[model samples]
Structure formats: structure tokens, C-alpha cells
Target chain A: MFAQSLVGAAAAVAAHLETLLAEHQALPVVEAMGYATRGGKALRGYLVLESARLHGVPEGHAIWPACAIEAVHAYSLVHDDLPCMDDDDLRRGLPTVHRKWDEATAVLAGDALQALGFELVSDPRCHPSGEVRADLALSLARAAGARGMVMGQALDMAAEATDVPLDLAQITALQAGKTGALIRWSAEAGARLAEVDPAPLTAYADRLGLAFQIADDILDVEGDAAMMGKAVGKDAGRGKATFVSLLGLDTAKLRARQLVDEACDALSPYADRAENLRAAARFVISRSN
Target chain B: MFAQSLVGAAAAVAAHLETLLAEHQALPVVEAMGYATRGGKALRGYLVLESARLHGVPEGHAIWPACAIEAVHAYSLVHDDLPCMDDDDLRRGLPTVHRKWDEATAVLAGDALQALGFELVSDPRCHPSGEVRADLALSLARAAGARGMVMGQALDMAAEATDVPLDLAQITALQAGKTGALIRWSAEAGARLAEVDPAPLTAYADRLGLAFQIADDILDVEGDAAMMGKAVGKDAGRGKATFVSLLGLDTAKLRARQLVDEACDALSPYADRAENLRAAARFVISRSN
Candidate 1:
């Protein structure tokens, strides 16, 4: 049931993004924008839709932010794959945007995607209350800007440049900003949309995000490239410090399971109504990709 | 009087941006963000502040959007100057961001600056009304997204790759998106903040933006590299289609003057209260850089 819901949310978000992209002029960058956004797991969008469902928010209103987060995620991936960054030629088993197009197109497409993300959330169609829309845009900017994802990316790059590997606490802080911030924002979005205190969801997301990263590290170590749809064992190859490297594979697995349990427990305030969210927590640790 | 106001607006916006950037972690990307934002004419920011003043909006509230537009402008310039793009080495008499830092830092800095733009406009402190803030963010996204500045940039790049030069109408349309969208947005922002119709200011900006581009073309043809603080005569050397190239230098100058007159005429609704704006339109054509 949870898997089906996740698939449904992905399809919905993809369709909505298609509609938005269709409204744009037929430029190559626009085409690249659409191309880059395709084939992601859409986990962030799923979190948004599921959390909104848990909060009784309508699918119509929630879909905008779902698409918004997906756009942001796609943009980060596109830029991350640039030759100057990760220098990856492939993502999700296909050529990255910079490989298919050029660096300029990739950069512009990524930029437009980020702008589109802001556009989707702040648009009046997303919510009737402008206050809610403004809050959403502001929070998203915080998640994506200098103090959040970008800072994490910079720190990661800096760490890679040095001979010294990062310690556990340093890695945790970096992961929290790089990936955790967006995940937390996605999970807590419904509460923000509903104008409720997001304390419980925040707690749930904090644990879920860490579990998600640990799972990613584990996948990098043990998962097959075909199953992951991208390069695997890259962290170990680069000698980059990750959960699996720092904690050992067995201990990392144990820690991820514990974190999943803690994440599920944080959803207790919603009782059985949050079973889907609980399933999502388990899925984070179990998924190969 | 116009020069003084423009300089004053630039200083105020710069100081506000400095305060905002000071709050972020001192990452290399964050430092690059500050470097990229400095030394511009701040024309778009000036338009925002002057328009807000015309609409009786306080400086405290207007400064956010002013800085927001500047950030967006800075991001575009940073990305445009990338090695894969315009490959510019100098801007405002100093090394470009990519020259000073690495390409990765430049890309991340530009991305963060764009996010900062949306954050500033949608911030609660920017306005008292949520509706207005949301509107500002939505409009800014439109101006900066695929349909606006990015489209213009893509078209410009496409034009460069082909042997065929764009026709007058095609070039006009391209420039309208490239530089005109943000200028129109800046000019119309005060009315949006005041919750009034932006038709008059939009009219003024359309003409002013066109005139500004023609003047830029003229500068490229006849400018001193030392005074321009960047390359000159490159458009002619590349045989690119431009206002001066298509219309001839004398005709381009004449057209710019006529557009300035039309832009000034559009502000008749404000009568003598719009003297500063009239001065701005003239300055757009008269300035050397």
C-alpha cells in the first residue's frame, strides 16, 4: 500500500510538472528543465503528499509544493552532476544534463528549475492564504540557500579537498545541511500548510533524514549499480568518509534501523493515521536506492 | 540629482545585503556571493527603490525587494561569466567570480544568490501583507525563470552558435526577455507593493528597457574598454546581431532617444512627482557604461 501511494504521488507530481513546463516557451533550456526533472525517486514529493494527507489538506493544494520540492531536488541533482562538481556523466542510468546538453544549458536549466520551485509554492493557486504561500517560499529558500543545502555542498567540497577525513560529528552536520534540510522541510510541509505546530513532524523528520543518509551510505557500499540506477561504492572508491565507512557496515545497518524506529515513534501523535509515514521510515532504511 | 539617488540606493541595498550575508556561515560560496554582488551600477535596484518612493512605500520595506533584484542580477552575471558561457574574466574592473574562485564555488554561489533573491522578497519583514509578499515572489520567479531571463539567455546562445544572424524583430524579442523582464519587474514592484495597478510603470519600463539595451549596444561599438571596465567592440568582432548592428549606429542612437521620450511620457500620471524617473530614463541612454 505504501509503495503504491509513493508511485501515485510520483505520477501526480510528474504530470503537474509537465503542465507547468508546457506553459513555457519551447527553448532548449526549457526542454532540458523537463528532461532533468524526470526519473527521480520523487521521495520528497511523496513525503509532501503523504504528510498533507495526514493533515487533511487537499491533494490539489499539496500537489504544488510536492512539485516544488521535486523541482528543487532535480535542480540540485543537475548541478551536482556538473563537470566542476561531481563530474558525473550518468545519473539514474542516463546521461546527466551537462552531458546531454552543455554546461551553460545545464546551469540555466537548473537555475530555471529553482526559480520554478519558488514560483510554484508562492503562486496563488498553491494556497488561498498568501501568508501560507509566503511562509512556504521563505522556508524553502532557507532550505536551499547559503545556510542550508549550498553550505553543506561547499563543506563537502572543502572536506574532499583536504587530506584529513571528516569525523562522525562533522559528517553528521554536513549531511544534516546537505540532505536533511530538504527532507525535514518536505515532511513538515503539511503541518505548515495546516498552520499547526510542526514539532512532532520535525522530530519525525530529523530521525528519518539521518536514517535516509545512513541508508544511502550503506547502499553505496553494498547495493548493485543496476539496482541503484547510478554508480555504487563511489564513496569507498574516493575514500570519502560516510556512515558505512566511519561506523562499519554492520554498525551502520544497526544504527539506521534504530533511527527508523525512532522516526516511526515520533509519528505517534498521529496514532494509526500516520501508518503510511511509518512505512516510509522503514522504506528509507530498506530501499536499495 | 538622478546620479546621487542611484548611488544612494546602491549603497543602501549593498549595506542591507551585507547584513543579510553576515548572518550566514562563512563558507567559500557565501564569500563568493558577496564578491559577485559588489560593484554593479545597481540600476534595477534603483528602479525598485525609486518606484517604491513614488508609491509612498517606506525605505525599510522597499529595500528588501531592491536587494532582492540586485541578488538576482548578480546571480545571472555570475552564471553568465562562467567558462562555458560568456567566459568573461573581468567585471567591474575586477576578476570575475570564477576567476577569483573555482568554477564549482562560482556555480554554487550563483545558485545561492538566486535563492536569496526569493527569500528577500518573500520575507515577512519585506511587507506587512502576505498577499503582497507572495505576489512579489511569484512575479520575481516569472522574471527570472525559463519564460523570462533564461529564455533570453538560451536564445542568445542559440543565435551565437548559428551562422544566421537574428532579424530585427527576433533580436527585439530576445532582448525583451534577456534584460527587459527584470527591468519591467523592478519598475512595477512598487505598485505591486502598494497594491495598485502596474500598467503605467510597466509601459515606462518596456520603453526604458529597450532604450537601455540599445545604449548598451552602442557602448559595445564605441565604448572605451578602460571606462567600460570590460571588453568592448566584441559584438562587432563576433558579427553578432545587435541594435547598432541591425539599425546602424546613428539610427540606434536616434531610436534610443525616442524610447526615452516615450518612457518619460508614460509617467505623466505622476506629473512632477516623477521627475526622478524621467531623469532615470535619460540616464539609461546617456551613461557610458
Candidate 2:
């Protein structure tokens, strides 16, 4: 049931994005932006919609933040896949933006997409109240900015430059900023929109984000390249310390399961209304890709 | 007088940015961001502050938007000078971000700075009213996104791929979106802050933006490369059409002068109170570097 709901949410978000972006003049960067954002599982978008559903926020208002998170996610991927970063040629089973177009177009497309994310959340259409819009924009900016994803990326780069591999604690801190920050924001977005205290959602999201990263590490070890849509074993090859490397693969999997359970437990206050969110936590650990 | 005031504004904005960015972990990307934003003329920031002064908005409240625009401008320059973009090696008499740091650091730094810009404008410290913060974020995003700077950049790249050089009108449209968009936004910021009609400021900005581009074109033709801190003659060498090439040097200079006069005329509602703005208009045309 949760899987079906997630699929529907992803579809709705994609349609909204298409309509929103259709007005952009048919320039190459605009086209590249569309390409970059297309065909994701839209996990972040689903988190937003599910959390909103749990809070009784309508899909209409929730979709803006949903699309906004997805756009920011897409932009991060585009920049991360550039030659100077991950140097990945493939993403979502197709050429990355920098590979499909040129690096300049890739860079500009990513930059514009990031701007569009903020635009969507801050627009009056996103919410009737300006306070909500301001809150959403402010939180999204913090989650994606220096103290968040960018900081994680910088640390990752710095780790690559260093002779000593990162310890488990250091890697956790890096991942928290890089991937966890955005995940936390997506999970808490519904509560923000509904003007409810986000303590429960924040607690749920914090554990879920950690579980998600550990699952990623597990995927890097055991997943098929075709299913993952990119090369696996990159973490081991780069000699970067990941959860699997530090804790051992079996231990990493056990930790992820424990975190998933904790994440679900944190959502118990909402009872069955958060069933989808609970399922999402379990799915993170079990996902093949 | 305007030049001195601009210098002071730049310094103040720089100091504010330092305080905001100090919390960032000591990573290469953070360092590159600092380098990218340092020591510019801060024309956009000056516009924000000057326009705010004209509207009787306090400098304390106005400084946030001023710093925000400057941060966005710095991000654009960093990305524009990348090896895949203009491939310039110098900026503001210093090495470009990508040249000073690696391309990955440059890309992440630019992305972070853009986020910082939005974060600064949307933060409550910028204004107590959430409505004002939302409005500023929305407008800035639109002005800096695909419909604005990115659109201009994509057009520029596409024009390079074509056999035909862009005509005068086409180039003007391109530059208007590329450089003029931010200038217009900077000028209108004060009106937005004051919640006043921006017609006069908008009119003043439109003409001023055109004159500023024309002046840049003139600089490419005749300015000292060392003083400009970047290569000159690249436009002519690339066989790109510019104002000087299309209208001839003398005609281009005359057109810039006419635009400056009109920009000043648009500010007549404020009379002598807008003298600094008028001086800024003339300075755009006459500045050596």
C-alpha cells in the first residue's frame, strides 16, 4: 500500500514539475534541467507527501515542497556527477547532465534548478500564508546550504585529500550533513506546512536518514550495477570509510534495521496515520537500489 | 561621493558575510567561497543600499539584501569563469575560484554561496515580517534563475554553437536577461522593502542596466587587461558581435551616454536625493576599469 502511494506521489510531483517548468523558454539549460530531474524514484517527494498526509495537509499545498525537495535533490546529483566531483558518466541509467550536454550547461542547469526550488516554496501559490512560505524557504536553505549538504560535500572532498581515512563517527557527521540534512527537512516539511510541532517527525526523520545512508553503504557492497543504475563498489575502490567498511557488512545491516525500527517507533504518536512513513523506514533498509 | 559610499557598503557587506560564513566547517569550499566574494566593486550591493536609502529604509534592515545580492553575483562569476564556461583565469585582479581552487571546490562553493544569498534574505534578522522575506526570496530567485541569468547564459552558449553571430537586438536581449536582470532587481529592492510602487526605480534601473552592459562592451574594446583583471579582445577574437562591433565605438559610446541621461531622468521624482544614483549612472559610462 505504501509503495503504491509513493508511486502516485512521485507521478503527481512529476506532472506538477512539468507544468511549472513548461513556461521556461525552451533553452538548452532548461532542457537539461528537465532531463536531470526526470525518472527518479522521488523518495524525497514521497517523504514530503506521506508526512503531509499524516498531518492532514492537503496534497495541493504539500506538492510544492515535494517538488521543491526533488529539484534540490536533482541539482545536487547533477553537480556531484560532474567530472570534478564523482566523475560519473551514468545516472538513472542515462548519461549525466555534464556528459549529455556540456559542463557549462550542466552547471547552469543545476544552479537554476536550485533557484527554482526556492522559488516554488516561496511563491504565494505554495501557501496562503507568507509565514509558511518564509519558514519553508528558510529551512530549505539551511538544509541545503553550507551547514548542511554543501558542508558534507566539502568534507567528502577533504577526506579524499587526506592520508588518513575517516573514522566511523566522522563519516556519520559527514553523511548527516550531506544526505541526512535534506532527508530530515523533507520528513519535517509536512509538519511545517500544517503549523504543527515537528518534534515527532524530526525524531522519525533523524533515524530514518541514518538508516538510509547505511543502506546506501550496503548497496555499494552487494547491489547489482544494473539495478542501481550506476557503478557499485566505488566506496571500497575509493578507500573511503563507509558504514560497511567501518562496522563490517553484517553489522552495518543490523544497525540499519535497528535504526529503521527506532524511526517507526518515533512515529507511533500518529498511530496508523503514519503507517506509510513506517513502511518507508522498512523500505529504506530493504530497497535493492 | 557615490564611489566612496559604494566602497563603504561593500566593506559592510563583506564583514556581515564573514560573520555568517564563519560557522562553516574549515573546508576548501568555504575558503573558496570567501575568495570568490572578496574585493569586487559591489555595484549590486550598492544599488540595494542606495535604493533603500532613497526610500528611507534603515541601513540595518537593508544590509541583508545588499549582502544577498553581492553573494549571488559572486556565485555567478565563479561559475561563469569555470573551464567549461568562459574559461577565464582571472577575476577582480585575482585568480578565478576554479583557478584558485579545484573545479569541484569552485562548483560547491558557488552552490553554497547561492544558498547563502537566499538564506540571508529569508532570515528573520533581515526583517521581522515574514511577508517581506518571502517577497524578497521569490523575486531574487526569479531574477537569478532560468528566466534570468541562467537563460542568458544558455543563450550565450547556444549562440556560440551556431554559425551566425547574434545581432545587436539579440545580444541586447541576452545581456538584459544575463546582467540586466540582477541590476534591475538590486534597484527595486528598496521599493520592495518599503512596500512602495517601484515604477520609477524600475524605469531608472532598466536604462541603467543597458548603459552598464554597453560600458562593459566598451571596456572590452579599450580597457587595460591588467586593470580589468581579465582578458580583453576575447569577444572580437571569438568573432562575437558586441555593442562596439555592431554600432561602432563612437556610436556605442553615444548610446551609453543617452541611456545614462535617461536613467537619471527617471530618478527626477526624488530630485537631489537621487544625486548619488545619477552619479552612479555617469560612473558606469566613464569608469576606466
* Candidate 2 chain B: 10-residue stretch with minimal lDDT: B124-133
lDDT of 2 by residue, B1-289 (tens): 7778878988998998888778888888998888888998888998998999999988888899999999999999999999999999989888889888889989999999999988977876666353535888989999999999888888888999998988998999999889998999999999988889989999999999999998998899898799888888888888888888899888999999999999999999999999988988898888633
Task: State the local distance difference test value for candidate 2.
Answer: 0.89
Looking at model 2 chain A, report the run of 10 residues with the lowest lDDT sum: A124-133
Off by over 4 Å in 2: A128-132, B128-132
Q: Place model 2 in a CAPRI quality band.
A: medium
* Candidate closest to the true structure, highest lDDT: 1
Residue clash pairs of candidate 1:
none
How much DockQ does model 1 earn?
Answer: 0.76
lDDT of 1: 0.91
Q: Interface-residue RMSD per candidate?
A: 1.3, 1.3
What TM-score quantifies how close candidate 1 is to the native fold? 0.98
Q: What would the TM-scores of all predictions be?
A: 0.98, 0.98
lDDT of 2 by residue, A55-83 (tens): 78888888998999999999999999999
Model 1 spans > 4 angstroms off: A128-132, B128-132
